[model samples]
Target: MNDHITTPITPDLLRGALELERTEHGLAPHRLPVRARAQGDGQLAMAEAQPSGVRVVFRTRAGVVELDTLRTRVGYRGMPLRPDGVYDLLVDGELVAQASTTGGKVLLLDMATGTAETRPGPVGTVRFDGLADRVKDVEIWLPHTEITELVALRTDAPVEAVPAGERRVWLHHGSSISHGSNAASPSTTWAALAAARGGVDLVNLGFGGSAMLDPFTARAMRDTPADLISVKIGINLVNADVMRLRAFGPAVHGFLDTIRDGHPTTPLLVVSPILCPIHEDTPGPGAVDMEDGSMRFRATGDPAERAAGKLTLTVIRTELARIVAQRSVDDPNLTYLDGLDLYGDADHADLPLPDRLHPDAATHRRIAERFAEAVFSPEGAFAPQPVTA
Candidate 1:
């Protein structure tokens, strides 16, 4: 009935990815490779496939564009409902329109009962009509919060993959804060914002609740192509209450060592946890304080635990600074960034973290602005080098 050229989506059109695997219905873009997926923790395996900053990019003169996606959505049975993920369409690098699929698949979990269920949905399509006839670069940003599979791509005019240009690739990994916990959309995530401001291509490894310096993560970073890299550590360490002081230092060292094996001279920045007042001096296994329907985080570990080598933000910062200082003696490219520089007490007074853990949208913007200024400045660690002919 209709006569539009429908093109099959393939890896060539995708950006900010390390590997792409063909799925039964579509293509699954992964931040980590198959080998890394097989060896990493279940959380890492799940998080790496979410396509945080990944997008489908191409150059075209199409007057209309349509995208078909198979999204796997997540829902909490008894908790607050998660909003539908957003897809950003950028025309020549500027946001033009936003889209989200209606239905594909849903994974529901009954948090109170510890039961979970999966429901199959349908493929949904988003179309943007009346594009200018001139050739322009188009990017369809995938939802950072959803696990999406690319089904197909259609355009009225022919499309071609755009070869990467001068922009450097930024590979970053961290906790929920880095994962865009409360960020509104994929492109608006702090990492993406910082990348935009810094004029770099982002490969965000900011996996929610899975930034625990796993060797698999480090190896994945090692293998991925990146010009600059950063690892934000500590919050997950403190909140997950996973390691003791005895193991924390070695774990940090081992994680860095694995990355160094692959990126011996790449600009590698080690960032300590941001200012979290509750866990400033206190230890944690953060717990939820469900008051009415609102959920807030509370540090459950004791302050005295620090004396026993339990990790805290203050303690972690001191150790991370020490590690970078010592390593920089031999590896000049290594650098350290105090996470507080991104979000600290003074700024928190003005823009407080709404949930006592994750920053709200406004805070995310502020942090991204600060990150861009601080890390991309001329003297900054990841500053862009002037390109030469």
Candidate 2:
């Protein structure tokens, strides 16, 4: 019985050892070549690799300027204005692009088109044109008096890979409210807040004025990876009147069915629209003036159309809950959440939506607090249930 055995080293054991070593001594460093630059008259200029391709540059002067390239628009709230100034973009420290403005507002840039425009106004597209394939390195320069913040910068880098572990991803889709509308900061958006509270990673697909149950958006949600998901629908549909009741139900089912293709057993929650009296039981599209007490109601359809239960917010909320209820019998992991539960009649009375449509910063914080308690807490509603026979 004098036999000897040898243990084979497995990949997992090797990886564990490597990780332990890294944690103890830190990562090995690589030497970077250094370069010298010309210095003159108390000024020092350094030479670094010029970043290739078109990139946005942001600087400050007297007033404030913000650049947002994302789907959502930027808001300056209100800031003091300075004299006329030219905001310029330089390539290799040479002037190549510019936006002329009177200062004190949000500015938008479209690097793809090399165009710049002001916002809380018209939407514009920017194209880089003939320099698309040949351009590298970009810089932004503002006059010596304005203050600025770079909200977003376009990038072409490949997305980083997910870390190895039992990952849980939360996918949320909604309208402008979820798109950080009127929120004080990007990190303060309700979706971002909820994600932080719930301790889960998120892929926010909120699109302002673009969550109208489009087939493409549905397909995108269907294909995206998720461990848990929720869709805050209805308000945008009601405001837009994109479809009638007859079509709305089927669209909702289709949307859910598409998502189920990828996340069959994942926990899914369907939410209704929060209370907005303007569209509660009203029909068609309308706009209200916040400055004055003026209302513009469109006669897109007759009163009977509303009576027949078209795309009213109330009707959609009721039907969405019903659909999810019925579906839950077969798919136990599915659930329904009344959006008003986050900011019900009581909360609304205190923190009313500023524009009579979207919630302001204070209201957003309130909703995030309630949502964390209700859905994200350990003993909250979304907690996993015990398996049954």
Candidate 3:
């Protein structure tokens, strides 16, 4: 008989989630708080529930660990089924094992109709054994693309919460790219990788298809305690085509103002969208192109719409730069980073986006490396400030 001790899943053992909801089976970690979720639409609800950056973290001497979870995975009605969500186990901050559980629920989506169907399934377990019998920090990075509910956690030895170290808390909000769209695993996402390199605790708010500048989201960020903050804007706004240029500028300002209300001196970085060819000069209401059973996306709005205040990648970038410059007069901690510097036309030629929408796994790593160099290095904007008396 396998002897293991069952430990209740508690908030202290979780990282990167804004709130935890008590579910019938166990607990579901939500990236957005309850208030924000209530105001968000179905897209935001699904994105936040995906747990892009959430993890189960603790310290243990156990040689074997098992986690029972109920995961809700997304799928398209006609597109090829996505691969099972991956669970990455890290021992002492190094990826030690990667596992996945089967038989969880599936939410099949209809791309053209914007509707979805849920198929219920039973809970499954992910097990990782053969760890060296020594005390070490362990983190199980939940699948970034799945809605995972923690049912139970078991280990051969006792587990305890890891001490809060001196690492800075990085709270970032952005679009699906920041939400680990095509990243292989949770820990590999560009934001997650950048957080690891920066030696910071990541609180990711990169909701897929849901990075709209909502007031509630800003309030949540304002209330959340963090040493560093960043918001990647433009892409989602352009693709969704929800707001025009007339409304975009004020929305950006309002978003930053709200964040400053709570974190007046914290370093804030405003990043524009990366190089997206179709949406660079053209407006959007981006549409799906299911060509030959392969999924692709394209900007469908007319380019001339720019004359009427329609937003585009290029327009958004110029506005964001101007906004940051205007705000920096009094907010010295505010900074702007052009997304093209992270991924530009040159990059597209070398590492084209697989879906023409989201970056591939390798690109995610590349973005993370670039971001670390630009924001976390000694000379970077987010580098530690000097003390003065």
Global local distance difference test of model 1: 0.86
Alpha-carbon local distance difference test for all models? 0.86, 0.53, 0.93
Residue lDDT tens for model 2, 45-144: 1001110111233221211223321112222222232223334454434555555433234454433454545654322222222222333433333221
Per-residue lDDT of model 1, residues 1-389, tens digit only: 15678786767788878888888888888887788788867456657778889999999999888888888776777666578889998898888889777888887766687676879988988778777889999999998877888888888788998887558999999987887888988888899999999989898888887888888889989888789999999998898899988898889899999999988999999988888898899898988787777778989999988889999999999999998999899999999999899899898899887888999888889889988898999989988798789
- Which is the leading candidate under TM-score? 3
TM-score (C-alpha, index-matched) for candidate 1: 0.96
Candidate 3 lDDT score at position 184: 93
Runs of candidate 1 with Cα error greater than 4 angstroms are: none
Candidate 3 colliding pairs = none
